[model samples]
Target chain A: MPATSGHAARPEASGPTGEPFLEVDRASVQYGSTKVLSELSLGVMRGEFVALLGSSGCGKTTLLRTIAGFMMPTSGSIRVGGRDVTRQPPDRRGMALVFQSYALWPHMTVARNIGYGLKLRGKPRQEIAARVAEMQALLGLEGLGERKPAELSGGQRQRVALGRALAISPDILLLDEPLSNLDARIRLTVRHEISALQKRLGITAIHVTHDREEAMVMADRIVILNAGRIAQIGTPQEVYNRPSSSFVAAFMGAENVVPLLVEAGGERLRIAAGPVNRAAAIPAEGRRLGGRVVEARFRSEAAELHSATAFPKEKATEDALVLDGVVMQASYPGGVWRHVVKIGEATIVVDSSHAFASGEAVSVKVPAEALFLFDATDCKEGEEELR
Target chain B: MSVLAETAAPARAAAWYWIPRAVLFGLLAFIIFGPLVNLLLWTVTEKWYFPHALPLEYGFSYWGRVFSPRGNAMGSLGTSALVACLTVFLSLLLAIPAGYALARLRLPFRSLILLALLVPNAFPNLPIYVNIARLFYQIGLNGTILGVVLVHTTHGLVYAVWIATAAFGAIEPELEEAARSSGASAFRAFRDVMLPLAAPGLMASAIFVFLESLDEFTGTFFVGAPDVTTLPLLLYTSAAGGNYQIASITALILLVPSIAFMFVVERFLRADVLANIGR
Candidate 1:
């Protein structure tokens, strides 16, 4: 594998008045023989919610723990508010971690759990009391001060865990799959609550999660990781629309994998799918030339499936984007019916308004811009690994 | 209709295993309790020889003599209680840290330490007593209550650590990590998360240590004689001196704590904890 370690410098401060609340500079972490992260670097602007999104073992959680000072990086340095905290212990770093399991002290009542960090820092009795009360009110844990963690429901336990982390008024809140343990319905509600809380407090948060949609909905920018390396870092919309690699494209929910060839010109690029995709125009230029179109992937929502019997009366060259296939199967998926159309040896799954019966001739209509093309070898490798 | 279905059902009686097990338990209970009852009968009776299956005579005369103001039995009871209490206390304090580390810490040499603990069990009992007695001569631990406690604790620490460590290890590590991340320091995390969770294990270990200290014969006989007369030592002395009635009474006395310890072990100590933890 080519080493793409050095790409861009630590992002420059946004004009004047911009200081990154947490900065991770070329941080690498290893546990025994496993290298969890390698020379990873990131910076979170003050109050910005950034989600480290990755499949498991992609070092997302390791990065979050390193920033929280739980796991010391083998190399590189971390700074919060321009102060180097590479050697500081977690409690001394002024950052709080909300664990995947909530980690609420089972022995402690909600109020005491919330006040524990303050007590550890040796705050005065009255001040600790005041802060605890304040946190209880803010978290809407008014009558729950006396309840032990075991007595609380999952959602309540989650709130208590958050309250405990927030009670200390941390500079940066570190959340490690904080909503992953909750049921799906409660997860959505808690995600909104956490996002609202982060915004209200104006606290920088670095959330690590495996769920891509959760990251998209909650984070201002999502950092996608692959293996022990970062694959892409962009705003959710930017990453969803224009993934740098096929890995990110699939991770962003573009499920349709098709093979295509890229023919590049001065200002425009044309892509031709191997009997699977219609030749479509993509906005690619200097960097995309000279590669055999081995594979392409499109979102299911991006392709339109039609019966091949309705193939246009025009010539194949004139309808360069049209392909013939037989509808193998179809299912009603919510808003529209979805069909799996088999084109000779290749199969493209597409969504359609009208249902096409099995064995019927069909053609998948893929808009030019919705298609994502990648190098054939890399595409095959990514697809195989995902499987 | 099918050979396979016909062959699947075995011809043997399903209840065949129960009868022998019930008979075995009955025999076991008799064997365990019969001696104690014989001793109880002998202590109350004046004399018994080969001719009579039952005691020849019964009276309160032996009990009166044993509990009389001039008797040495009460003094032996005092000595045994003091020594057992001290041994349990000291052994518990030592076992807590060792057990906690063995249970929770993933330290590199944990297995080595555990092997070292088992080393004492491999030593010959007589040589152990002689070596300990020689060491006692130098440190003035000779025949002293503290010396007896020290020896018992050393002998008992293995069982204590093994049992308590299993208990501590059975507690979920997540609870401790939760406490720590919730802002408790390492020490406080153990106190808050681990202590309550392992309470039954600690109690079980404590009861075993207490009973072992109380019933100790070889160590106390070598190191605690002439001065510290624990109940077990006193019973041994009476038995050796041909004082059958006093020996039987003392034996009965010794059985009480052991039985109590057995009850505690049965009720609270699930051997499953040890099985899972040791593996």
Candidate 2:
């Protein structure tokens, strides 16, 4: 893939071996003049669950629609199992999509809804019934086949939708936020069940989701999208721990941002002090720093808060960075106490087990391993981006 | 004692709260049904006098007169039924496709087409029908069932298209997407999903067209007079000639379907579909 495409290199574990089961090569979808999706390319390995993760209107759904052949791309081609299917209609693409709304036929019973595809294929009634029963059994909807979609609970309705899609046994499965409709508790269980089902069936699936943790829990590889382009694609752990950009870091819950000036010297990258962050010389190994000024980020839980006068100066800032701030407010969210600390003109959240007075002076220390650095100028910070 | 007084006072207030509503409802019922009761009384009246508030004698003699072989009421009713049915068929044949496009597709000048449908309903029908009848006369179609049916269809299409659009629009587009992704062709998806979901609304629209065509008078008069007379035309002639009994029976017959079908339309045109009207 070209570097300009904003795509991540294929993970080493799932490297390009032979051919991808579904390959979206240079797919560009445009609605009139506005480009909803730019020249996007993706290669999904057979039996791999890849999630297209992004905020709303970030083109994740657009990409899924294009892949499903519902919305044809203005440019580029889509290939499945090494065959060009860009011009084919959704029905001929041999991929089934489970819609977010479930989209069950209100007029039909659950059995008919699941067996509709098979019936359309001219399958015998007995065969269709047999397949419908099998899918119902797999999705834990065996006794609900006689019920209409409206009569089923939200979770059960979701399973009926899944059963309907899986009944066709297509080459690929596309899930468009199938669990987002369920209540929070139900969403958790359904998430696990879908992941287990995908693994058990060894089905190649592409899931679109705006929920970060949903993608983390359900997908093997997450394709992070931003502004109609691929920001990064990697395993959930990789993207969370080693995000390629500041936007990814912020999106992945490292929202507390402070600027830093850095110096690259042979084997070590030195982070100089600014208005908030202290000067720290850390190992540059495995760090992809390009510019002298960088944005330093650390999650709330990763930073340790201590009283300004009690903090150990001898610990040194050689490998760790510290910020001097005052505690603005504190709240207990279950296990830990979270505090909003005012550092210079900005506010950063810090979580510490030890209680601190609201107005007390404190210093937040983030170790080198926890601190994420990115080119400062590359991520333009604006007033509206404070969150 | 205080608690008892509070409970009793609220109970009394709540019980009397419905008094005004009941009176208003009674007034509305009277306004709607008073004329019908008079028409019904006339239909059965065997004899009456100028000084009598009610009929002096009551029987089904006029109904027999209207239904008998000598009466033209039955013949005119048959013509009306045929014309209304044809009007429904023609209106729906055009409306269904037009509605689907208006509801689902991004057709160019969509608002223009939707607005143009209102033009048939915008002006007084008498003048339009006069000009239309003149055109039909030139084409040798005046005084024929086909010409009246055509005129009724034009009137019925207004309701047919608008309501059908609302009905089809009320369906979730994702249902069709779900169908297509399940290996169904676009046409099959529409047949198996979109059509079934929109069926109730379309039925309601059809009923509206059917009822509108059935009760149509002015258009039928201008286009089908002297030959293809409908129930409304028959009613007009009897009422004008002071045969109140025959006219009342004819009106009661025309009203039967309207009353029956409005109930069905109420049941099928769901609140959501009703809310989506014109939008």
Candidate 1 chain B weakest lDDT stretch, 10 residues: B6-15
Candidate 2, pairs of clashing residues: none
Question: How many clashing residue pairs, candidate 1?
Answer: 8
Instruction: Please report, in order, the local distance difference test score of every candidate based on alpha carbons.
Output: 0.78, 0.87
For model 2 chain B, give the 10-residue run with minimal summed lDDT. Answer: B110-119
lDDT of 2 at A319: 73
lDDT per residue (tens digit) for residues A45-108 in model 1: 7888889999988889888878877788999899888899999866567788888888776667
- Clash count list over all predictions: 8, 0
Those runs of model 2 whose alpha carbons end farther than 4 Å from true positions after fitting are: A1-10, A307-316, A378-387, B1-31
Candidate 1 regions exceeding 4 Å error are A1-17, A124-130, A285-290, A309-322, A378-387, B1-22, B46-50, B56-69, B262-276
Model 1 Cα shift for residue A118 (angstroms): 2.9
Q: Is the docking of candidate 2 incorrect, acceptable, medium or high quality?
A: high
